[model samples]
Target: MYLRKMLFILLTFVSAVSLAACSDDENTTAATPTAKANVKVVHASQDAPGVDLLVDNTVAGTNLTFPNNTGYLQVNAGTRNVKVNVSGTSTTVIQANLNLMENKFYSVFAVNQASAIEPLVLEDNLTNPASGKAHVRFIHLSPNAPTVNITLTDGTIVFGNVAFKGSVDFTPLDAGTYNLQVRDAATNSTVVLEHS
Candidate 1:
């Protein structure tokens, strides 16, 4: 009879503990939804002056010079107006209406010479590469540059037939230092640029 009573008490305790666990789970709140996107801006216009980048009329970057970039910044996702104005001035040089979606990444580049500067928007894929690999991408921002191939110094082509303003998608490469060069597509022998 004593054993029966002890078994009954143990069963009751187990039941109460299970119920409390379930109750705690039911009271827990879920994470709130986010309505934001990440944006980065690059100044690729060789002849353009230092500039300010504005999103929805609010300055996001000030005095961004040629070849400089404003790294990823989070902003409200929706129809947003982006503008570039000469630094310390009210004169707007480039503007665009960007329809950004939530949870995505975007890059905006100011390209071409100062006289004809324009914005180039690109969706960015930031997925991680495989283990022991790295991601690389190429963008041809030189306005007058020709179709070209990117190659290793040993002459293996990594990217081919990219023209002016063209961009190569992110590709995985084994992580290591590489000596690379840009060669004309037509002959694949004339070196345009070289980097180590």
Candidate 2:
């Protein structure tokens, strides 16, 4: 009788230990890390009011006016629902389904005018520039602006023949301040915009 009781208790303890080990394995599998991506938002709509950026109905940016931008935010890799709404309101002015890949970076630009607002999604290349250099790119966000050449004040064209809503790849430049001008591409002499 004593031997049988000892044997029963040993079997029960062994069964409980086995179950606990199996549970730990299941928990480890469920805790696998999720793939992720990085994204940034740029408010470039020329005529739209200050806006908010939403990802899957969650506000990612708020009260972003023209030419403002939000820093990169990490998100799960997959198709994400992106939306832009007027500041302080739930009225969605633009929405898009964006496919984001793991370990990549993206930029979402809210562009055009209030009457024709849209999203311009661009993949960002984050390759490091060479020493003493920086990366530069040109994006034409003016809704009604003409095809233009981006140039230095000295008339050296940095980006040529960029039309409205056009964009250019990143170029390496020596780290320094630059005086830039947007000139008509046809004539390349009429400065429509200037920046330093």
Candidate 3:
């Protein structure tokens, strides 16, 4: 009888332990889900002052200066629109689709997409702007130059430089509308040869 009682006690203890373990598992909570990825974008171009940088119809910044007519964009892993304009020429309009990703960087360059050719070289008064303004194609031909700088009438200055030539060509500005002061940091000279 005593042996039977001891066996019953052992079985009871095992069952209780199992029940407790099961209860603990049922009471425990699960972990939380992970968050989505973050994104960012940047834009710069030759027509820094004249070009408008837009992402998804949102105006990021405008009238800014850049070299290589290039820029950057950060967005979700999806499609985006990058529009370019030189103002008046028949080629004032240029556009591209940007593929963005979470926590990633995007590089964009304004070049012709039709035949793998370079972007149009914007020259004010040469073809006349659609806005009826003369423009400037601030070009930095010296790729070996350390930096290319631009100064506006308002005392605002912008700087950039490319290590290679044939990289980018085009800056659109209103002729006789704005004052532009450009210089090459390497040669300590101006890049925009002719200013109107």
Candidate 4:
């Protein structure tokens, strides 16, 4: 009788050990890593080696490049301030924050040098497509200029005042060489015409 009792206890102990080992194997797990983010820029004219980069008013990097006028830059998942300069002139400055996702691609392009902070002379229609109804747009780029008024080659009045970073659209009244006059809204005295 004692022998049989001893045998039963040993069997129970073996079964408990086997169950414990199986439970541990099921609980084991693996981990996955986070992804990366990317950003790109495209323009009619590219930024040269002297361009500067900033993040939240902090200089992050500079002197960007791309052979095809497409510059590529990488940043962590967060917001940044993008700054560009040409030679000695800071042609333009822009502030933007991008929410980047892990392992994702992004593009931030500043095709026009005119930022909202500056005054500029805007001649909206450059291509001058003969389609009378073709649309053209102009925007001011001077920091202290306003309003856009100009006399066409024919001495016709168009656009009065445009604030800095403001825009004007022109639907060519007639298909002909129209001299564009654009001035800031504040100082109507300063106006420029794009002569074709």
Candidate 5:
């Protein structure tokens, strides 16, 4: 009889522990329904002045200049209002509503001339590349520059004729040092060069 009682107590303890663990797991799952999203603001307009970025009317980034970006801003996943204003002025340069998904990444591009600025939102590809490979992407932000080809010093064209405010998809290459050059597509004149 004593042995049976002890067995009953052990079974009850096991059941209680199991129930507690299950309840805790359920609570954890419920608390994590949505994840945060990351957004980057890029200033691509060649002549536009530095600007301030706002999220829900709050200043998220300030003094973002041409051909640059505010690396990444973490925000809750939902519909959001994004606004860009010229620095130290009330002049609103760009305003738009963005629906951001959980755990996603985005880039907001402010492009065109200062008088006629435009906004472009692009979803970033966040997929991981294969092992032993490096991934690279390019954004063409120069307003006056013509369509350009990104080439290696060896004369191999990696990306061709990317227009102003355009971008090239990420391409994977083996790890190595490279000399890259950007040339005007029409005239083949080198505009930018870098070694990496």
Candidate 6:
């Protein structure tokens, strides 16, 4: 009887151990690492020379011209000190703090004249548009240009009354050739015309 009781206790203990091990496996899963953020620099100041983008005092881009963009820089998620400087010069044009979140997209714009340069942080929504559509966003970096209207060459208004240094969200357009025009809103004077 003593030997039988001892064997029964041993079997119960083994069963408990087996169940605990299975429970541990059911509770655990493979952990995924945190995603990184993406940043892009744009030179929007027309009067400023080619500029450099600095993050944490490190050069990220060099010699970017007006309306040019630095595709995307992958960075760890955190706060970053961003600076814009004239290319190859120590003269810092602007300084700002960028709070970067994981798996997000950002555009840093260097706008206005050199003496009073500014940074515009634009958070971009990277959602894919519907089929046969294109995503287009507009920025008004022309400092002296008046509030303008964007239209097709056929006078179809696209963006109405966009002021200097202002911008608009991305709108989906059909895939096709576009003759774009930027005209002064108040006087209807043509400011820019492009065939694309």
For model 2, the local distance difference test gives 0.75
Model 1 TM-score relative to the real fold: 0.81
| TM-scores, all models, native as reference | 0.81, 0.79, 0.31, 0.37, 0.77, 0.78
By the lDDT metric, which is better: model 3 or model 5?
Answer: 5
Worst 10-residue lDDT window, candidate 2: 5-14
User: Per-residue lDDT of 58-165 in model 6, one digit per residue for the tens?
Assistant: 999898887688988997778989888889998888989889999898988777776788988888776676677766777777666678888888788987888866
Per-residue C-alpha lDDT of model 2 across residues 87-183, encoded as one tens digit per residue: 9999999999999999898988887778998888888777777777777777777766668787888888888898777888777777667767777
Ranking by TM-score: 1, 2, 6, 5, 4, 3
lDDT of 4 by residue, 52-166 (tens): 4554555545554422323345566554455554324455455555566665555443433333221122221233444444444443433333344554545455644445445
Give model 5 RMSD, 1 decimal. Answer: 19.6
Question: Residue 84's C-alpha lDDT in candidate 2?
Answer: 90
User: Which predicted model would earn the best lDDT?
Assistant: 1
Error of 1 at 119 (Å): 0.8
* Candidate 2 Cα deviation (angstroms), residue 70: 1.6
Better candidate number, 2 or 4, judged by TM-score: 2
lDDT of 5 by residue, 62-176 (tens): 8998767898799878999999999977789899999999888898988778898988787877566566666677777656667888889777898888887677766677656
- Candidate 6: C-alpha RMSD to true structure equals 22.7
Clashes of 5: 0
152: Cα error in model 2, Å: 2.2
RMSD of each: 20.3, 21.9, 29.2, 28.4, 19.6, 22.7
Off by over 4 Å in 6: 1-34
Model 3 TM-score, 2 decimals? 0.31
| lDDT of the candidates, in the order given | 0.76, 0.75, 0.37, 0.41, 0.74, 0.74
Model 5 lDDT-worst window of ten: 5-14
